[model samples]
Target: MPLGDSITGSPGCWRALLWQKLQKAGVNNTHFVGTLPAQGCGFTYDGANEGHGGYLATGIVSNNQLPGWLNQTHPDIVMMHLGTNDVWNNISPDKITTAFSTLIDQMRVSKSTMRILVAQIIPMAPSNCADCGNRVIALNKAIAAWAPTKNTTSSPITVVDCWTGFSATSDTIDGVHPNNSGNTKMANSWYQPLVDNIEALS
Candidate 1:
């Protein structure tokens, strides 16, 4: 399941690119699961994802949305790149991570041994939010610190660094969403970790 905001959906071509990479690598056994269908990547791939546009991680937890999505999809592995909207809203890092912990716990309830990949979200520099860049840094740092403590042999949480080697100015089309280069970079960032998890399950 690709879980996040518009970065994971709303024409999230990174998912398409990642699916292509997985196919090329012979990872045919895997499937992208989510309540939402693919939103136009210009080609066919597993477009089902939980990438709700204009959604906040905190709001998702507050409204108890993830569990229903989890119940419906029942994915064995989850690739989450949330918290971008949270940062954009000026929500504190600690609160956002707490929401993350709740979401992880919910995932475990659905499947005790769920393999989870969480991203240290890419940078943001939206025109309206000048402080978003620094906020993203803080949120990513919090996520990096929080993930290891939650990692377990039963349900490991690996933090994929989507921040480094990614440029908010160059990679994003609007400083909040990825352009073509950004999509490629995001897909590449997720490729190896996803492949390793898939191999582990196989």
Candidate 2:
């Protein structure tokens, strides 16, 4: 399950491109559910184009809905790249951190061995939100700096560095979401690392 906000839910964004690449790479027939549809996403809903989007890392965790959603899927891996919307909402970083920690706690699910790769959200530029700059870098830095070194509730919480590759070219569609080309680049950013580390995990 890839959990997060508009970036994850966007129709033509990286995740969607990643799905296509996975299919092309022969990882097919997997089920994907984007629950953040009510907020207006440029996504396919029952084969319809809809734009439902908006989310905050803290808000998402506080809801208790993500746990239920995760359980419904029984996911082997959780790819989480979130928190931009929280900045947009003007939520304090501390609260965002707590929400994410709680979300991780909920996903741990009694230590059943689920690998969580929290992709550090990259910098988004030329946006109106005061915090939209490399605020993502700071948030991601917090996760990157802390989660992996310390033990997480989940077995191994790896932080994928989306900030590295996508940072310079991070802005694409509307400077908010990555356009198709940028999305492909984002998928490439993730693929090799995942393949390298996938075999090492339990």
Candidate 3:
């Protein structure tokens, strides 16, 4: 499922672009499943996702929501791009990582073999929130370090760097949220990981 915050839920959200790209590439049997129906993206896709706009990592985990979603959807793979809101809210990176770990564990509890693609959230524009951008960088580093330890004999968590080439000034609408170009970049970033893990679905 396309899972995250507003980046995955917004109308022109990257999830739609990713879905559309995958469809065009012949991965037509896949479906985006989530408790929340897809909004925005102009009806371009099935619009199913777990992206809760403005949701914080702690809130998502504290509410114990992932387990229910995992049980209901039973998705073969989960694409996660969270923590933006947490950083925006000035939450500590350690807490953010803990929440993310909890989320991953919850998903594994539901399906041990499930594949998860965790994103290094995109850069924040200086005009919007400069300090948050640095936080995003540090968070991404922490997430990268966190992924290897998460690899299991069955499920392996892969980290996709959505921030490396993402230029906030050019690719975002409001520094944090991605625009069409940014979404396209995200879609491309997810392509290989999706392809590499597509076998999990089969």
Candidate 4:
């Protein structure tokens, strides 16, 4: 499951790129599972994802949305890139990470040995949110620290860094959503970790 907000959906082309990469790498048995169908990505691929637009991590946890998705998909691995909307709403890093923990708990409940990949989200510079950049940095840092505590021998949580080399201004179409360049970068960031997880499953 490619789980996240608009950055992961709302025409998230990175999913397409990642899928293509997986195909090219001979990962034939894997399926990208989600409730939401793929948006227009200009090519054919497994576009199933749970990238809800304008959603918050806190909201997902409070409303208990993840369990249903997990029940529906029964995914062995989940690649999550959420919390950008939460940052935009001025939610603190601590709260966001807490929500993350709750979500992870939900995932474990669905499957004890779920291999999870959490993202250090890409940078954002939306005109409406001045503090979004700093908040993203803080949240990513918190995620880096928090993921280790959640790591287990059965269900491991690997944090993928999508922020290090990405540029908000140049990569995003509107300072929030990724442009083609950003999509490619995001896809590259997710590729290896995801491949490793798939290999482990095999």
Q: What is the C-alpha lDDT of each candidate?
A: 0.95, 0.63, 0.84, 0.95
lDDT tens digits by residue: candidate 3, 1-202: 8788888886536777778887888988788888788676665687788888889988999999889888888987898989989988888878988998898899888888878999888998546566887888888988988888777868889898888888988999888788889988988998888878886667
- Report the lDDT tens digits of candidate 4 across residue range 26-103: 888899999999988898899999999998999999999999999999999999999999999999999999999999
Query: Which candidate would rank higher by TM-score, 3 or 4?
Result: 4
Model 3, residue 123: distance off in Å is 0.6
> Clashes in each model (backbone N, CA, C under 3 Å)?
0, 7, 3, 0
Q: Which of the predicted structures, 2 or 4, would earn the higher TM-score when compared with the native?
A: 4
What are the per-residue Cα lDDT tens digits for candidate 2 across 72-110?
A: 556666677777787666666667777777777777772
Q: How high is the lDDT of residue 178 in model 1?
A: 98
The sequence of per-residue lDDT tens digits that candidate 1 reaches over residues 1-202 is: 9999999989899999999999998899999999899978889888999999999999999999999999999999999999999998899999999999999999999999999999999999999999999999999999989998889999999999999999999999999899999999999999999999999999
Native-referenced Cα lDDT, model 4:
0.95
Q: In candidate 3, residue 133 scores what lDDT?
A: 78
- Give the clashing residue pairs of candidate 4, or none: none
Model 4 spans with C-alpha error above 4 angstroms: none
**Each prediction's Cα RMSD?**
0.6, 4.4, 1.6, 0.6
Reference-based TM-score of each model: 0.99, 0.77, 0.93, 0.99
List ranges where model 2 is wrong by over 4 Å: 23-52, 149-154, 167-170, 196-202
